[model samples]
Target: MSTCGGEGPEEREREWEDAAEAVAYDSSTWPPPVVAVCGPGNSGKSAFSRLLLNTLLGRYKKVAYLDTDVGQPEFTPPGFVSLHVLEEQTKDLTMLYLRPPKRCFFFGDVGAHKNPKLLLSYIFGLYDYFLQELYCFNETDDPKKSAIPLVINTSGWVKGIGLHVLSEILRYVSPSIVIRLRTTSEGKNLPDGAFWLDVREGDSRVNIIEIRASQNSPRHLLVKKEARMIRDLRLVAYFRQCLPRDFSVFSYDDLVQGFAAIEPFQLPLSKIQVIDLHCQISDDAQHDFLAGTIVGLGSSKCVSLSTECPFPWCIGLGFIKAVNIPGNFILLITPASRRLLANVDIIFRSCIVAPTCLLQLQVSDEVDDITDRLRDL
Candidate 1:
């Protein structure tokens, strides 16, 4: 929410306007430009992406946002790769997290290091959906009503396998404008040039722009939020809404305490099916593995748990407070709407876990270590 230069709101508008002009100067010719914002951590990618989105709103009715940064998603909670079609203009991108995503995939893990291929597949699948279902190529239907432009916000790990993932994304999405933010530190910059073009040939030329990190932006990558704190805040913000609206008079401690006192929603284990995408565990151990963990609730068309179910359409996520194999029941805590939760038939043991801060009894730093080990399974 912080902007560099401490400039007035009007001054900031001018800055984004300049960038937008460069990208969409000829609206008729370059109607909807697909832009991907990428860089190392704390390089102001999120802020810049918002600025670009705001600028584009002046020209386009809607802008499609493909959030690939599961560790610190701009719109949703951590551990999801989601695609949201932005219809309303947002003042601050961070302030737009209240709504659920139009579509999302639960990757379970915070980062793609463990399963880059699956992450890539999710991104590609979302993009394909956008192109096939959302995009409007015909000029007759009304250019003003055409499919929204896409802006991709990537994770900051732009080195090693991270860089490779970004490269592969560029090759796959083929955004018309690629905005790469570079911090003062040269080492943090992504390799110079259009790296995605190293071995691949594209039908169109890709425009690459490198920008410096904002001067007044918070030092989130290094100091302000250490990854755990960011994730904790995201989870807290999400679950805090589950409380009754009249029950708003409380401090964070009071909220956490109140959350713990509430009886969890119980689901019969017989009617629900559990699937783990990353590892294979025996049926006997499935309940044990799911207990005291965060899992995604979804509805799948498949009938049998004997074979792999198609990728589920996640309706919501919940923390498993207790699992009783003997009783064939699971106690869960989640803030999702009751209507959506009613249709839940499948549960995914994903990489996502409630932060230790949100847990009733946990040390401040225990979740990072504990979640790492759990995700590795």
Candidate 2:
């Protein structure tokens, strides 16, 4: 475990002043500036966001997709961003977050790692995350800021105060290109903008990423261990009017030098559609991320859930206990998701989503008695 092989002359002038503060692009050109693209969950960060938005706007430039990839945001292309449910009630059962509606759009739903803000006077409860970093570095309501490059699609649940609020929003609204994609199984890499450190356990910048702490890689290996686990990630430099999003925080091994270019990449079944949720899985690498298709939610049956795998704990790592929970609410299936819901009009296009809309009041009359006992059986 020996690194820092060579460097002096003030550590190569602080590594060329951290690579010119990582390509500062305070927006100037045309609608081509804010490039954010982060990584971690299922780590393909949306197939590197469709390979960097069809390789920088080739698929016709209106490119928006702002799900901000919050927690576990799925659905892509279909007119994007809609669901904004947030209900709370502990003991009597009622909890759901599905966020992302304002503070700069794209939030369809999901937010539950809860209590984790390093300090600086609780950054005033992140007033809706500093109101989307004040509309992503407001340069007159986003003149695309430093130039139409707004690429933020993060959320793979990082620690140390959300990686120092993503490095104080890249030093406050300064992004021209901070593309950091990471998906590792066992590969040694890092290059696309490098500072994703999360070192601990007798740390020593652990060579920037000895991160084999599996279940689906989470911590940094070293970009200077993000200033000591960002000291609990200091919520917001003791809060004072917030303003920050400059851009540049990476560590999917600093940008791919290993991890075999992110394995598990196979979704092209014409864009992969298989939602047969009669889940009672016995995963051999999760039979293609839980096959798909199946519905019923009055009393929401089908419960195996061994600790987790509801899909957004950032792609259910902890390897999901080899999955096969006999916990009840039965819905088990496998002959290929029962032949991909063997069509009952494609299982009536599937519907059973009560993780919380406050269960629309404990399941609106039990989902109309489970949709009239699933249409009289």
Among residues 3 or more apart in sequence or in different chains, the pairs in candidate 1 whose N, CA or C atoms overlap within 3 Å are 108-351, 108-352
Q: List per-prediction Cα lDDT, in the order shown.
A: 0.73, 0.29
Provide TM-scores for the models: 0.82, 0.24
| Residue-level lDDT for 110 in candidate 1 | 88
The sequence of per-residue lDDT tens digits that candidate 1 reaches over residues 1-377 is 11223255566546555665666555553547888988888877888888777777767778888999989888778888888887777866666465687677788888999888878877887777777666767755675536678889999899898998998999888888888766657777788778778555543477776555654355656753577677877877777676676776457677767677555676878889888867757767888888668888887752222112137556777888776665566778788777777777889887666766456733223334444554677
Off by over 4 Å in 1: 1-17, 93-96, 139-145, 199-204, 215-225, 261-263, 280-283, 302-310, 361-377
lDDT of 1: 0.73
- lDDT of candidate 2 over 304-358, digit per residue (tens): 1222122110111000001112211112211122222232121111221211111
